[model samples]
Target chain A: MQPTETFFSGFAPHDLWFLGEAALRTLWLSLLAISIGSMIGVVFGWLLSVSRIGGGFVLSPLLDIFRSVPLIIQLVLFYNFAPIIGLRLDAFDAGLIVLIVYTSANVAYVARGGIEAVSQPMRRAARSLGMTYWQDMRYVVWPIGLRAVFPAWVGVALGVMKDSALVSVLGYVELLKASQILITRTQETILILAIAGAFYFALSYPISLYAAHLEDRWNQ
Target chain B: MDYNFHWRPVFKALPDLLQAALLTLEVAAISMILGVLIGLGLSLIRIHMKGPVMWLASIWVELARNTPALLQLFFFGFGLGAFGIHFSPYLIVLMGLTFNNAGYLAENFRGGFGAVPDTQIRAARSLGMTAFQTYTRIVIPQVLRIVYYPMTNQMVWAVLMSSLGMLVGFRELSGETQFFASRTFRIFEYFAVTAVIYYIIVKIILGASRLLAMRLFRY
Candidate 1:
């Protein structure tokens, strides 16, 4: 933490150990958000595919607003205003709520769009096969829609991973905030930020590659 | 504990918040324009560059798309100062956003270019159009049309991403809200009003883009 300290020379073994823990924390939070959010998205998306006014008119617009607003501002609001709303959430829970809501909005849109894109003629064919609405959805729409939605879900998962850094602003001590802590202690921004960026890239890139793999497989 | 609703603090901070919203718009607008140009250039490089050069372009896209924007902001804001080079918060954020926008838009523009039929380019070339003239007259216009929706999406993204400037202590709309909310202890009201402003700004952009789409794509 000296004035003339080098970012590399100032680095200790435990600075990395701290980063490891933060990476794990970031991973768990993003996984939780994506898993739960995608589940909620499937239900809402299915509903949207079926209903016009409620899904098209209301839910779609609501989700657009959610996507348009920045995640950090939403974090700040939910964290600070929890008390006013009679909600007693710790920082982790508050962060999770924001992550889930944000992820779900994006996923829901993807899911709905995917369902709608599953060709009208195929649905008519399914109907001619004596399939009930539920049976048709279970057999046809869900499979086709899910295939189209997977690539987008990958994007949402990566987006949630990056935006998870914002939860640090709410004092969650996640990866980015932990790096901020390290910067204060070591007085080296370059090394710390670079490591943080690399960690995020490591976390996100594999998921993307996997999505690409699945997309190719499905396309074939 | 029961909470009493207050609108006074929100009303008093209105002018500053509006000004800050404009600043946010300015940052987004400038970065988006710069981003589109850089993105176009980068896409050209991605398509035309060979071997290591193309790999380098792809790396930029991957890095920018994958990492957190906040990290890029911090790197520009604080990391460069480690080398005794300081950037103003505005400049740092602009740099960060430009980097990010170029990366995402490069990929987008590449796809746009792909969507343009090869036959058109060949047809233009056969008619004695120079390379530059072919691009300007035939290819780029179609690429712009193909990518227009993605461009608007990027605009909304830039506007939202500009809020990160607050973390570097740059006072855009969210930053101003953070400032006043803490001072007035009106976190809810300030953010609520600010949220409405963000919502309105996004709505306007969406509305305007819709109108433009209808008019321009009326084929």
Candidate 2:
């Protein structure tokens, strides 16, 4: 088939509406997942830094297991296992849950780094000032730690967005799955895929650019 | 459906799964080697290449870095076939992974290269070394030392990303697991086994890389 023939044939008028809906779903799902994931990551990360179990030599290996496992495998496990535990969710929910768990693992690591970046002198000074641990953390340590690791957090956020595409395999009507559906129905494989790629770029590039700006601004 | 946990089927599948695991390693190793070379070249261009070459390299790096590898794999696997250009699924997956890894690796390498102190380069030049010799003798070695940990992390990430190849029918570990699960209706057993395999592979790679880095780059 001629490339143009394939391209033109693939651009069905009605499919545009379907693609739009899919795009919206993808964006909504991704935003929700990332927001929740970030929360989990922040909390877990803070715990990792402050908790006694998180402080010792065992911390590295504990984090290692979370870091080493693939997010896709984690998703598959959740997708299959969630129903068995009475918390039944559709593909989208399962995907979001897995995203939270997987990205939290990363966030915990980033958060730990952020916490560590808070200088010892600062913590000592906070203690000397009669600030309680919570007060010191809330008023001083967390601020510095957050600033130090904001760039990495942004990168992780972007990672969550991109990794969201993996959820398409679980039958979520994500952008990639939408494109795959279009490809199968119309067989305009390249054009639709390119459009899908463009959609992903549209979704992710702005956040990345924003991250670059924040990194520069924060570093300055 | 009662989930029956059977060790026999999982054990019976081990040899085939091991073969698949070996293929996964083969693909990852080849892709990483190529990715490192491409990433090094790209880093050089980003740092030193003049004019359009630099601009193009930066754009490539940004585009690849921002995009998901799964989309890239699909594009290479399915998109190219529409244009009368065909490669095996394995090659397409490899190319996709290589490009993805190269972009990240380029950034890592650039960071490493930038971390090298200017004084060291100056000292090398002052010793009558040419630019190339100075880079190879002094700058590159030091940069590698600085970037060893991050590079190892990226290599681990590369191994994990290889799981996405299953989506394109490349029959890596994940692919084999999915196949067996579907055929046998042993979802948990198959996935759990493969997950364990993946964890083992990652652990071994991480451990090996750490030792190798310590030996190679120890000051």
Candidate 3:
């Protein structure tokens, strides 16, 4: 494990491929968490919007814990705590669990906001048009509410992707962790970091720009 | 799940953990102050300047905003070390957090500045106020007011983000927790306590911000 003189190698051609694979891991991890967590979050968000006392008293504070504490702590806590609780989970699973809840906590608020953005009169109009409650929700609320919060949800998704770097603490070989490993072996810190940063920027910047564009268009 | 929980070790380390928590707050506070100052300068540069310096500011803002914070910390840690410029872990964390905060705050400041209409600057200029006077007395105050809530949220973000200090070997709250958990092997218990401390810290920051907002914005 000692980084002796010969142990340190220069960056080689294959290193780019290594980084690409690691980037894929980051993508999949965040994608899994966002998709599943969004589903759960939207349901909970709907509940929160409909039931003042139940959601406020019970679910809101429950989810708020994930928001308030640092993701690093939550990752560490869940990773270590899982073994004690007989979960027998590995790093990826533990990281995924924490990421899922963190994503859900965030998406819940956005989903609730999206739900609330559809005015009462609008929902009532849909209902008075002989639509059932579910029909009103599915036909009327979802479209308008989604447009209002799509940008925010994109922000959350990007935030979670960047925050996935913290999952490296659990020894998951995501993009950042892969860079750390390469830095140790190659001793090419700046080069490897630049490459890794480019990978992230390539992934993040265009999405953010597109989100901004959509927001501008919608606002207009 | 037959694991015996050990609260005693965590309780014994409570004072040290609390002290580390204070260090976390201190670093976050210092970074926030530095971030706001640098961010103000950066936003001004973006607004008033062109060419390489403005491009540099944009790159700084975009890179910091787009990249992972831990990667930025590593850039300060080992990336700088590659050039024979070394920093203590504490400085690495401080610099990294400040750099990230500055990037984010700069964007917020730009948005805040954009919210102020062109007419106000014109009015301030027409009053024969110097450029400095116009910005200091007229423009900056309004921008600050517009960005006050965002600044508060950013402060909360700074506190939470400082937990990354542990990765760089800085003995902040999360680092200290990791240290104790390693020693006592009471990982769950120690982190549970640490999480509560963080929650309290966030709540206090939010409460104080609200109270300060009441006083400062009572027009």
Best by lDDT: 3
Q: Report the Cα lDDT for residue B188, model 1.
A: 83
Task: Using lDDT, rank the candidates from best to worst.
Answer: 3, 1, 2
lDDT of 3 by residue, B23-132 (tens): 99999999999999999999889998999999999999999999999899999998999899999988999999999999999999999999999999999999999989
Lowest summed lDDT across 10 adjacent residues in model 2 chain A is found at A1-10
Off by over 4 Å in 1: A1-9
* lDDT per residue as tens, model 1, A16-132: 999999989999998999899988977888767788999889888887777878888888888878887788998899999999999888888888888887999999999999999
TM-score for the A-chain in each candidate structure: 0.90, 0.87, 0.96
Candidate 3 overall lDDT versus native: 0.92
Chain B TM-score, candidate 2? 0.95
Question: lDDT of candidate 1?
Answer: 0.89
lDDT of 3 by residue, A1-220 (tens): 8966586778999988998899999999999999988898899899889888889889999998999999999998888888877888988999999999999999999999999999999999998899999999899999999999998899899899999989999999999989889989998899999999998889899999999899999989
Per prediction, fnat is 0.78, 0.69, 0.86
Q: What is the TM-score of chain B in candidate 1?
A: 0.96
Clashing pairs in 2: none
lDDT of 2 by residue, B1-219 (tens): 455567678789999998999988888889889988999999999998889999988977887887788988888888888888988878987999898888988998998998888898899899999999998988888888877787777878888988998898889888888888888877777888888898999989988987897789666
Off by over 4 Å in 2: A1-9, A54-63
Instruction: List iRMS (one decimal) for every candidate.
Output: 1.3, 1.9, 0.8
Q: Which residue window of length 10 is worst by lDDT in model 1 chain A?
A: A1-10
In order, what DockQ does each candidate have?
A: 0.76, 0.67, 0.86
Q: Report how closely model 3 matches the true complex, as a DockQ value.
A: 0.86
